[model samples]
Target: MIVLGVNLKKIFNNHFQKYIFLYFLVIVFLMIGISTGAITIRTVDDTAREQIINYLGSFSSIISKDADLNTIKVFRYSITNNIQTIIAIWLLGITVIGVPIVLIIIALRGFIIGFTVAFFIKEFKIKGLTLSLLYLLPQNVFLIFGFIVTSVISILFSISILKNRINVIRRPSFLNRFVNYTITMFIISIIIIIGSLVESFTTPIFLKVINNYLTVFMK
Candidate 1:
């Protein structure tokens, strides 16, 4: 029993080390995406900047006036978008050619996040910072977590496929992996839904509370 316990500890540590490396790789890609996104803000042409400024002004006005947002529609849209993304990742994992795409998806998500925060801060200064925080933080906590997890697992499954291509696992082990991969992706989908709920319901309220204070920055 003691020997078995020690072997289990060793296996756990081995897995931790392996996954930590993968996690680090994913994080690096995410950061690169973010940096690229932030820098892209500075590269925007004057025409585009003006258009963005106009859009932000309009959005700010809506928030400040407490205009009705179609939360249900927003919820459905968010769910649909995330579901598409999740399904893409799941499919990619199966194809084993999706490793690069999976990483790119993570990077893309990071890019969007960075661009959003940078755009706000660039335009509104401190006020923009507040708006960005209120707008993104609540929902992103879950969304980003889901993104990272899904990306890593998808990549891992893809890698497993490659490694086992030459030396296939036993039937039960293969079935276990397939089930695990599918089930885990579904769980991540559920998590993304929670993030969507936050985005639709809670984020609006958060924005509403600060909309009055944000009007000054609109002009």
Candidate 2:
């Protein structure tokens, strides 16, 4: 972990003075996306709210009833979804045009998390907050940290390419930098995987226990 952090720091060591503020900007966008997502839940119609409630009930039942099955299914989904997101960010980070898209992706991730958390609170009130803190926040906190690092790296690489357009690809020095970027992304992917593992195994058990105790949770 220390080595990975050191490597990531080195990748931006030279450019830090120039591009350090970009991380703050990316975080602002992410926060905007999250706040927007939470607000969106309030705008949901009564019909949509009913649907969400129904879904929650079904989800609670599934996790509570079929422990092994839920674990397998959730693990598969978490792995597939998390890996695809990672790959998309990694690939998109390769080109300058992808910079805006990377920010959008981060925003979308924040939106999803915000919406989920808001929905839980809207439905279950205090109990939902407990669930969110315990089940929703832990894995997502690490994943968000990984994503923030990845986002900053994406912006930096794109800006780096733009600043050094004179035969950037042919320059072996650029290649070394690219290697560092790739390695950093690979490490972030591992962190993402670990987050997914927590979600897959821990989430199911957490939700099952919550559901059992909070019998009046949804319906």
Candidate 3:
């Protein structure tokens, strides 16, 4: 376990520059998400909150309180999106034109997350905020980590393309390169899985209490 930690640390450290880019990117996305959410809440007011509560109540009714089905779905979707985004970014970075595509992809992801969370909060009010935490935080941890890795690779590839130095970024060891990519992806997958577990086993219960309290206060 210690060895694995060290290896991951080394990989991250070696690509510190890319990590910096990823940090800025996440921050920008988060800001956009929060602002959009606030605007949405202001526009809709209380009715939106009731709608969100109704939606959650319906969703809870359909699935088991444990959240197993939802957790699995979230895990599968997040991993697929993370891997696909990274691969797309890598392939696009091969040409100068792909740089903007890479940033666009990242930005779009941020926008979606922001919009979704904001919509929920606006629709559900205080309860929506609590529920959003249960859903967003864990999965986000994984997404951000995966984004850092992919963003770093994209940066390296983009820089090489700009300098017309493809050879500097290319390695002949295809098997080794593939292994490294797999390891990084697996790390992301693990994080998502853990998040799903939290969402499934714990978050529902947490949200239940918030809903109960709000129900009483609203009376």
The top-ranked prediction according to lDDT is 1
The CA lDDT of each predicted structure is 0.81, 0.80, 0.60
Using Cα atoms with residue i matched to residue i, what is each candidate's TM-score against the true structure? Answer: 0.81, 0.82, 0.60
- Identify the runs in model 2 with alpha carbons over 4 angstroms from their true place: 1-19, 64-67, 70-73, 166-174, 209-219
Error of 3 at 219 (Å): 15
69-101: candidate 1 lDDT, tens digit per residue? 667867888889988999998989986889999
Clash number for each model: 0, 0, 2
Q: How does model 2 fare in lDDT?
A: 0.80
**Clash-forming residue pairs, model 3:** 48-123, 49-123
The lDDT-based order of candidates, best leading, equals: 1, 2, 3
Cα lDDT of model 2 by residue, 89-190, tens digit: 888778899999999998999899889889878877887788889888888877887788788887788877877786665555777988999997888778
Better of 1 and 3 by TM-score: 1
Off by over 4 Å in 1: 1-17, 57-70, 169-175, 205-219
